[model samples]
Target chain A: MIQAQSLTKRYGSKVAVDAIDFTIQPGTVTGLLGPNGAGKTTTMRMIVGLDRPDSGTVLVNGQRYQDLRAPLREVGVLLDAKAIHTGRSARNHLLAMAATHNIPTSRVDDVIELTGLTSVARKRVGGFSLGMGQRLGIAAALLGDPGILILDEPVNGLDPEGVLWVRKLMRHLAGEGRTVLLSSHLMSEMALTADHIIMLGRGRVIADAPVSEIIGQAGGATVRVRSPQATRLATLLAQAGVTVVNLEQDVLQISGITAAEIGDQAAAAGVALHELTSLTASLEDAYMSLTKNEVEYRTGGTGDDEFGDDDSDTTDAAADAAANDDPRETELQEAAR
Target chain B: MSTPTTLAAGTPETLADIGTEFVPASTPTGPHLNAIGIIRSEWIKLSTVRSTIWCFAVLLVVSMGLAAIMAFGLDLAGTDIATVPGTDQARFVAQASTFGVFFGQLIVAVLGVLVVTGEFTTGMIRSTLTAVPKRLPALWAKALVLFVTTFVAGLVSNIAAYAVTVAIANGQGLHASLFAPEVIFPVLGGALYLALVAVFALGIGTIVRSGAGSIAVALGVILLLPVVLQMIPATWATDVLPYLISSAGVSMFGLIQFAQVPLDWTVDLIIVLVWVIVSLGSAAVLLKRRDA
Candidate 1:
């Protein structure tokens, strides 16, 4: 288990990581989701003892990483894939790291085969492609077989087969009661791989929740009404205390109402609807809606004040308001009230 | 309760319970990277690189080639032996074993630079430090490797150059020191002198952390500053030049007539000390302070 309390890191005039606190529970894969320049790399570095924290402390298994009797056997990290010497072979790289903890050479060969680098184990790392390099980095991480595994961007350049292999690998590792903290920008990948998600933006923890809860709580219900009577249906829906946003001239986007309720309302009012569909957020939409304003980056010409803190997208706020009236979003609704 | 049984099985042992009940790591301690292991690692890295082998071979060829050429020319000239100033046997013969020091020192110094700088350029410093994060031990191991390799090679060059110089002098029917205080020290001193200078260069490589910067500074110290010092008045320039490691340090081995005003051997050793210890100390401190 890794616990970071009020962790912050600053480099010169720029703050790379703000006071972000989050815990990585054992026996699960905790995804650190963020865009580029979102302090994901810096925070990971601090946790591994590569960079010193200006403030706050990170504890691995109830002790600071630096104080661990044998750090390699407690926390294994793969910060950079190209950190190996070009002249040295892949086997030699793992050997040197293993030698630190007096780990056996047999274990070294086992990790080499586990990562599927046995064929090229004797080849120099200078000739490796990005995918091969990542494989080598994974091999290095598994060198000590530590309880906690921290990897930064483990799947940057992999074939489809390699990608599936990594997804299964992280899941398998976590299932064995190990703490797996992985950071990546790929939401779809995280959607499949992560058990819990901590979304970071502008160096702060903007959202932290379980994977199912993150998708469910971002928005409860919104109905897409497509009708020849779209305009007339919009006026009726507005009269019924439902907010309607015009998605297209023919399509009426109705929020604060269920799809079944909207269909029933339209039927009673004698409005002929061509199509009616409900939109409950995917993990992608939840991620975008949560990190819209705080994303730490924008190319340009996009309206900047994207965080309005309105609608059902504010999961905690929406979940809080539903407790008294809706009788849904349970477990959290009571605690929140 | 079931919890008490679980706690007894799971808790790690204290240091007092160390050999009798538990051995945490493969060794009782953590990592076991001593000076010997580090040196062995460095040697493996140094010898496997093709550049080290080529540079070492060049130093050998160039030094012997230069010595044989100079000895041949001096014999051909036949500059009358009766005149003490013209046919100084001590001065001419001693120059042979020491002639190649300058050219050989440059190549050896580059090897020294690469010893630390290659780790940075190739991104291997991260792995090197991760294994032995204490920092100074890596540099110490690098210095030891370079010092021994360069010194032993220097001794070989000295012996080879002596053989050529003796063969040429014998052909010309001239006598020289097969055993003399002046002759032995400089030949052996040339070996010691170049090796220490290379070790000093390796330290600078660590502190600068760039091959180009370290090499430039080393060259400026050895070659440029001495020449620049010449522009000063003769009295001041001469005094200061002899105190520098380049000028003062070399004279520890070089034989000059007793009448000549050169620093004593002890003074040269002191100058060498300042260069070696001071440079090495700064390298170690900067390494510990910075990120990997």
Candidate 2:
């Protein structure tokens, strides 16, 4: 468990990480989702002992990270892909990190193969592509087979196959009851990857709960009813204290009601219900809604919503759907191999 | 395998029958990430960087190269003049060996600049601090490794230059051996002075954390500031310059010190020590306070 108590970081007059308190549970993949400058990186840096918090403390396991004897083994952190020296081969880089913990050279080789960098392990990181550099970073992170893993934007440069491989890897690591805390602003990716989400908008966590629960709460359940008597049905739902929003000609979006409830209401009202569906908000929508007010660097406000990330959601969903096709994760590991 | 003891996260829940909720996060994991470990890691990292190797090689080349040419040139000029005052052909050749320490120190300063600056450039400083956690040990280890390596390397090169110069002078009919009474102090002092100055520069690099800033500051302290001080009417410059690491170190090479307050051998060593200690102390403090 990695716990940060009232962690705060300030650079001159600007506070980067404002006295935020959070904990990363074990045996779970907790996603730290936030905008570009929303203090996610600063919080991670403080937790891992890279940056000292001005007021507060971060504890890895029970003791502070600095107090840990075998920090690399206790908690592995992949701060960024470029953290390793570029001149050294991936193997040497891992070896050097391994040497810190007195871990054997064979373990370095094991992580190298684990991260699928065995083929390119001997290549200098300077020559490796961004994807390969990320792989090397993963390999280094796993060198100690640490109990907790902290990764900042771990899947940034991975290919589709590599991304799937990472998804499985995180799941597999979490399955083993290890703690994995990762940060990503990609809401769809977080939805697919994280079991729990901590949503940050500008250094403050707006929502912290199960990913599905957050999705349901922030973007309340909306019931879509298409009927010959849309206006009549809208009146009924509004009378029942549900806000009704009209979209197309005969469609009415009703909140605070379910599809089944709407069907019953329409049937009793003698409305010919051609179509009725409950559109629950996605994790992305929930995130955008909560962060809608606090996006520090808002591009524009005039659009339908600042985060009309439907395209990104579709792609990520498509990728997740494909990965989920084979219930047998064996295929993924095999394909990854 | 024993379960790794970590803090209970988020919503608290009872663990087992024991119900040991939050026991301040125990570390069944062994040794503390102590200062010594940080120092050891710093040593390995400093050694592995290619900048270290290249800079030392440059120090060797320039310092020894100066000795070789100076010895040959001085010996060749002494055909008519058998002896010149307190300086003879042999003495001049021995003295020739020590001139390069000044230039050699500058290159070492550049080497020191790269040591800390390279970490910033590559963003490895974050990783380093994460490993060590308490940032002071990292700085201390750097100063320890850099001072030792730069010092030893500087010393070896200086001696090698002296030996090679003696050989060249012998060939030119002016024999001066490394074992001579007057030979060891000047040559060894030259080497020690360069190494100490490099360490002084390294501390500056650690505090500044910039390649350009560190080298500029170090060079200015040694070379430029002294000139400015000398321009003043007060003879304080004469007293102050000798106590400066560079000046005191250089005086160790010359037979008759020109500076009014020429530091004795003990005073020169103390001055060098002061520069290293004070600069490194500032660096250590700065490192502890700053974010990685």
Candidate 3:
């Protein structure tokens, strides 16, 4: 478990990470989400004792990182993928780190094979591509098999297969009752992988909740209905608090209601339903809403409307198509089909 | 792109299967992280880099190779020491044999600076500090490893140079005893001087934390500042010049004394040590207080 209490950091006049408190419990994967320059990296660095906090304390398993008798065995950290001497080969790099903890060489080879870097383990790191470098970084993080893993942007440069592998690996690690905290700007990946997420904006935690709760809170679940009598269903679904958007002559997107409720109402009205599917607001939509005002660098006159003006039909169609393309939403669609 | 059969066959069904076999059946009982482990880790880090190997190789060749050339040059000159007044034959021979110290010390100094600054330049310091989070142990380990390696290399190079110089000088009838105080002191002292020069540079590297900046500062202090200090036409300037790093190094290595001002070798060693202590002390403070 990692606990950060009132952790704060500042450089000159700029406050990088404001006083923030968070508790990352074991047996779960927690995603730290933020825009560029939102202090996610700084917070992770503070936890590993790489950066001194202006005011606050971070403890890993109830002890400061520096005070741990066997740091690598307790907390594994990968702050930067390229933070290695490129002159050394992958095996030698892991060997040097393992030597500090008196970890045997066999374990080094284990991490090499586990990360699927066995082919190039003997090659110098300077020749590694970005994806290979990230793999090597993960290999190093797993050298000692620490209980707490802190990775900053683990999926920054990974192939689709590698991305899927990391998702499985993180879930596997958390399933083993270990604490995993990773930071990423890829909202779709986080939405699919993270059990819980901590959202940061302008050096503060803007929102913190479970994945389902965050998506639910952004804009509650909406149902997409396709019925032969869609026009009548739209009229019937339009109520005091429900919003029904007519996409096509026979398709209606209804929000502020559940899919079961819509189905029941359509059946009662004698409307033949062709398609009725529930859609959760994409994490991108939820994140944009939570941090639209908190973005540090904004082009002027954008007016904080991520999906353009509400009255523009072109933009509304575009937003709907984009939301439907989300991997999680697509998975839901596939499961429904 | 065939997957390794171990992982390809679904052997690692869970996180427990991933690295469980790699873990020792029984954790080593006593403290795994100690000074010795740190020293070993530092030795691996220092030896694994090609640049470090190249630097040491250059130090050995330049020091010993240049000494041989100087000895031959002196033999060709055929200086008659008996007729020349105020000529100490042993001191002259020792100086000629270790003339390469001037060039060799620069290489050692550069090696010292690169020992620490290289990590910072390549961003390896993050991985290093993450392993040893107390921070001081890493610094101390680097210092220890650099000191031992440079000291041994210096000793071997100086001895080889002395042997070659003596052999070349013997053909010209200038005899020098290896056991003679004058001959032995300078040979060993030259090695000591090189080692200390390296440690001083390591301290500078720690404080500067930049390869170019540290090297420039080290060279400026060891070479430039002394020359700049000499231009001042004052007694204090002349007195202080001998106390500078280069002058003290020369004196400690048993080179010709500064005619106007002479300091005991012990005093020179003390002065050189003060430079190391001040540089390393400040580096330790900043390293602990500042963000990586």
Candidate 4:
């Protein structure tokens, strides 16, 4: 278990991680979600004691990281894939790290095999690709078999197969009652892997809850309606707490009302309907809306309205389609197949 | 706990359903962080790198080669070579054996800087600091390993140089006992000075935390400071020259006298030691207080 209280860090005048408190428990995977430069990496660095907190304390397994008897045995951290020396081979790098804690060579070989890096363990790290380097970093983190594991961007450059392997590995580790905290900007991956998520925005905690709760709270269910009388149907469905948008000629996107209610109202109003489908928002859509104001680097006001306004139909429709093309939908389709 | 244990052990089919690839990670059982383990880790780090090997090889070759040339190129035509005093002959051979240390000091300085700066430049320092979070132990282990290894290498090179000098000078009627005080003391002292110079450079490397910048600062203090001081042509400059690191270091081995009044070798060694202490002390402070 790891506990932090009022943890704060600043680089000069700019605060990198504002005062935040969190507790990561064992037996589950906790994903730290954030945009670029949102202090996710800084918070992880502080947990491992690589960066000093200006105002608070972080305890790993009930002790400060520096004061632990054997820090590697208590917590394993993969801060970045480039933390290894380029001149050394993967095996030698692990061996040297193992020597510091008196860990044996057999354990090093075991981790090398566990991470599926035995084929390239003898090669210099300078020549490894980004994915290979990430595997090596994971191998190093698993060298000690610690009670807690913290990885920053573990699946950053991984292939689809590699991404699946990491998801299974994280679940397996947590199943064994180990505390696992991983940071990522990919909400779809987190939606599949993490049991809980803590979202950060501009050095502050924006939301912390279970994955299902966060998604449910961020987005209300919306329904897509198709009819020949699109204008009449939109006017009929418009009411208090309800939003209707004319998506092209025959479709209307309605929110704050269920599809059955829309269908019944259309039938009672003597309007013919071609299609009515309920659209449940994916985690990606929820993340976009939750962090829309917290983004540090906005691109040309493109992210101003995630649901798109009525003025720009083509661009907004394209953005909305892109947001809905999430991996959870693909997984659902595959399960159905 | 009892229910989960029963579920895990009761059904083989359930276990197989989770996939056979999910092997349980074995618990790590080992001793905690200790001085011996850290020192051993540092030794492995030093020996595995190519730069250390290259630097040590160059040091050995330069020492032996310079001794050979000095022994063969001595001018003995104007004097009766056989009639020279036995003590003076031993001093000549000892001087030749240790002359290469003058150049070897610069080589080890560069080696020392690279040992720490290589980690900094490659981002390996973060991994190292994370492993030993107290931070100072890593620096201490590195210094101890570098000092001991450099000392052994320096001793070997000086002895090899002495052997080459004896072999060549012996044919020319110059005979000196290897165990003689004049010959042995300077040989041992030269090795000591070389080892100290490497440690001094290691401290500078930690402070600067950059390869090129640390090398420039270390070499400037060791090589250029004395020259610049000598060119001042003042009495205070003359007095301060003896206290400079390179001047005192070379004087410690009796290789050269920087002061007009030549002080004792022990005093020169102390002067060199003070410089090393100051450099390492400040380095430790900065390393401990700064974020990795």
Candidate 5:
């Protein structure tokens, strides 16, 4: 288990991590989801004692990382894939780390083969590709068989096969009753691998819930209705709890009511309904909405005329929906507490 | 496409039927890490790097090779020491046999700087610090390993150089005994000086995380400062000149002696040690307080 209490880090005047608190329990894979510069790496570093928090404490298995008698056996951390010495071979790098814990050489070779790095174990890390480097980092993290494993961007530069392997390995490790906390920007991967997700934006926890709950809470099903009397139908569907967006003169996007309800109302009102389609929000849409306002660096509007003004309107509607959603706002407040 | 049933039928379903023993039955419990384990880890790190091997090889060849060249080129029988009023017989032989110390110190110092700065350059320090999160043990272990390895290298090279130089000189009808204080002490001091130079460089490397920056600073203090001090045209500068790092290092090995020099060999050893402590102490403070 990993617990961080009010952990805060500052680099000069800029705050990198702002008094965030989280608890990661065993027997499940927890994904730390954030955009670039959202303090996921900084938080992981503090957990492993690489960077000291200005004020607050992070503990692994109820003990400070530095105070653990055998740190490697208790908490295994891979903060960066390129953190290994490039001049050393993969086997030598693992051996050196194992030496610090007095771990046997047999365990070193075991991790090497387990990670499928046995073919290039004797080659220098500098010559390895980015995917190979990540494999070495994972091998080193597994060298001690620690109860808690922390990895940052483990699948950053991997092929489909390697990505699948990591997904399976994380689930396997967590299934064996070990705590696994991994950080990633890949929403699709997280949706498949993560049992729970802790979302961060601007160095603060914006949402913390199970994968299914976060997807459900982002936005419910929406119905797209096309009719000659779209304006009348929109007026009829307008209520205190429902959101209605008029995309065109004959089209209406309605939320907080099902497609059956829309069809029933249209039939009762004698409105000529051309089509009614239901759309479910994906995890990508959920993440984009949650972090719409927290992005640090944004590109300027190019004003490309090829796409016309319709694209900008759709983006604005999505952002508005994310900001004004009531259930998500309440959940954000609760997570902050 | 091969079906799972067909593949299973062709192979035995036992654990040994697999081509490799990839997984262990259980996590192996090993001995907990202590200072000894850290030292052993440091030793492996020190020995595995190619740059470190190159540096030690250079130190050995230069120290031993230069002494032989100087001893072979000397024509002792062609000149009378008494005719040269200020020339001391013992000092000349000791200095001649250890002429390589001047060049050897720089190489060892660079090795010292690389010992720590290499990790910073490659971003390996993060991995190192995470493994030993207390942080001080890693520093202490690196220093201890560097000190011991360099000291042994220095001792072995100095002894070999002295023996070779004496043999070459004996062939030219000149003699020096290994038991002579002038001969043994200077040789011993030369090794001690090289070891201390390496430790001093390690400290500077820790303070300056960049390899080039630390090397420049170490070389400046050991080589350039003495030359700059002489041109200052002040009595105080001249008085303080003997206490400089290079001067003290030279005197500690009994290679140079002057009446105006404030420190004798014994005091000079302490002064050089003080330099090591100050450099490493500040490095330890900054390392512990700074984010990796």
Candidate 6:
């Protein structure tokens, strides 16, 4: 188990990780979800004692990482794929790390095989592909068979098969009552693999809940309605919490209400509906909406020009909702991948 | 380790079938991090890298090659072999045997800097620091391993150089026994100085995390500082010349004397050690406080 209390870190004038508190429980895969600069890497570094926090403390297994008798046996951290020395072979790198904790050579070979790195283990890490580098890193982390595993972007450069292997490996480790914490910006991957998620926005915990709850909390499902009298139907569906967006002359995207309620209201109001559908919100949409305000480097496109003309405070919310379809957010996530 | 029966039954079966194949990790049964394991880890790290091998190879070759050249190129003209006294003859042979240490120090200095800075440049220090999060043990281990290995390498090269020098000097009718105190002391002292130079470089490497930058600084202190001080032509510069690391280090091995009043070899050794202590102490302080 890892517990952080008011942990904060700053680099010069900029705050890298603001005061944050979290407890990662054992026996589950907890995903750290955030944008690129949301302090995910910094937080992980502090947990492993690679970076010292400006204030407060982070405890791994009820003790500071520096104070642990055998840190490698208590916490296994894969900070990055390139953490291993490039001059050394993959096997030699693992062997040197194993020597630190007095871990056996058999365990080293076991991790090498476990990570599917037996073929390339004898080769220098400098020549390995990015996928192979990731495998070597995972192999190092698993060398001591630690109870807590912290992997930062473990599947960043892996192929689909490797990605599947990591997901399964995480689940398998967590099944044995180990604490598995992995960080990624890929909400879809986290949705499939994580039992719980701690979402960060500009170094602050924006959402902390189970995966299903996080998905359900993205304002629930949205309803799409196509009618001859789209404007009239939009007015009929309007309420205190309802949000209606006009997609075209005949289509309306309505949220904060159900399709059944919209269809019943439209039929009662003599507004003939051509089509009505309930669109469940995916984890991707939830991530975008949650991090829209927290993106460090916002991608520029048509949204800026649209938001420029409407400088009024009242139109800001409506303009932002329209800018959601700008596609730049998807591009940013793709760029991160 | 518990069985994964429920884990296999719960998740959907995929083509990889990775869930069933996964074996849970057991608790680590081995002894925790200790001094011996850390030192062994550092030895493995030092020996596995190509740069270390290349540096040590260059050191040995240059030492023997320079000794042979010095012995062969000596002009013993106009003086009969019987005219020179035994102590003077032994001193000449000892000087010839240890002449290569003047250059060997530079090679080992580079190796020392590379040993630590390589980890920083390649991001391997993060892995090392995470493994030994107490931080100081890793530094001490690296220093101890570098010291011992360089010492052994230096001793072997010095002994070989002595043999080469003696082989050629004997042909020129000048003889010096390897076991004599005048000859053997300098040879052993030269090797000790080389080992100390490497450790001194290790301390500098820790202070400057970059490979190129640390090497430049280490070489500058060992090779350039004495020359720059000599060029100053000042009383203070002359007075401070003997205390410089390179001057005192070379003198400690009876290879050269920079001071007008030659210091005892023991005093020179102490002066060289003071430099090492200062460098390593500062390195320890910065290493313990800084983020990895």
- Cα RMSD of all models vs. native, in order, equals 8.1, 9.7, 8.9, 8.7, 11.1, 8.4
Candidate 6, residue A286: Cα displacement in angstroms equals: 1.2
Residues A130-191, model 1: lDDT tens digits: 99999998888887777778988888787888888989999998887778899877788888
Q: Interface RMSD (Å), each candidate?
A: 6.0, 4.8, 7.0, 5.3, 8.2, 5.2
In model 2, the runs with Cα more than 4 Å from the true position are: A119-124, A220-280, A296-337, B1-40, B76-93, B253-258
Q: Sort the predicted structures by TM-score, highest score first.
A: 3, 6, 4, 5, 2, 1
Where is model 1 more than 4 Å wrong at Cα? Answer: A61-69, A99-101, A220-282, A296-337, B1-36, B76-94, B163-184, B234-236, B255-260
Cα error, residue B113 of model 2, in Å, equals 1.3
Instruction: Please name the candidate that would achieve the greatest lDDT relative to the true structure.
Output: 6
Model 6 DockQ reads: 0.36
If the candidates were sorted by their lDDT against the true structure, best first, what order would they fall in? 6, 4, 5, 3, 1, 2
**What are the per-residue Cα lDDT tens digits for candidate 4 across A183-231?**
9877889989999888876677767777887776655578988899988
lDDT digits (tens) for residues B1-292 of candidate 2 = 1343443364336332122332223234544455555666667677776778888898888878988888767634435443443235546755777777878878887887777877776777776777667667677777777878887887788788887787876665566666665676677777677777877887888888877888899989888877787787787777676777677667766644647655578877787789888998898888887777
DockQ of structure 3: 0.31
lDDT, candidate 1, residue B77? 61
Best by DockQ: 6
The docking category that best describes candidate 1 is incorrect
| Span of 10 residues, lowest total lDDT, candidate 3 chain B | B1-10
User: What CAPRI class is candidate 6?
Assistant: acceptable
By DockQ, the candidates rank as: 6, 4, 3, 5, 2, 1
Task: List DockQ, one per candidate, in order.
Answer: 0.21, 0.23, 0.31, 0.34, 0.26, 0.36
> Which consecutive 10 residues in model 3 chain A have the weakest lDDT in total?
A309-318
Which candidate achieves the best TM-score against the true structure? 3
Question: For every model shown, what is its TM-score relative to the native structure?
Answer: 0.75, 0.80, 0.86, 0.84, 0.82, 0.84
Task: Please give, for every candidate in the order listed, the TM-score of chain B alone compared with the true chain B.
Answer: 0.82, 0.82, 0.84, 0.89, 0.84, 0.89
Local error of candidate 5 at A200, Å?
1.2
Scanning candidate 4 chain A in windows of ten residues, the lowest lDDT window is A308-317
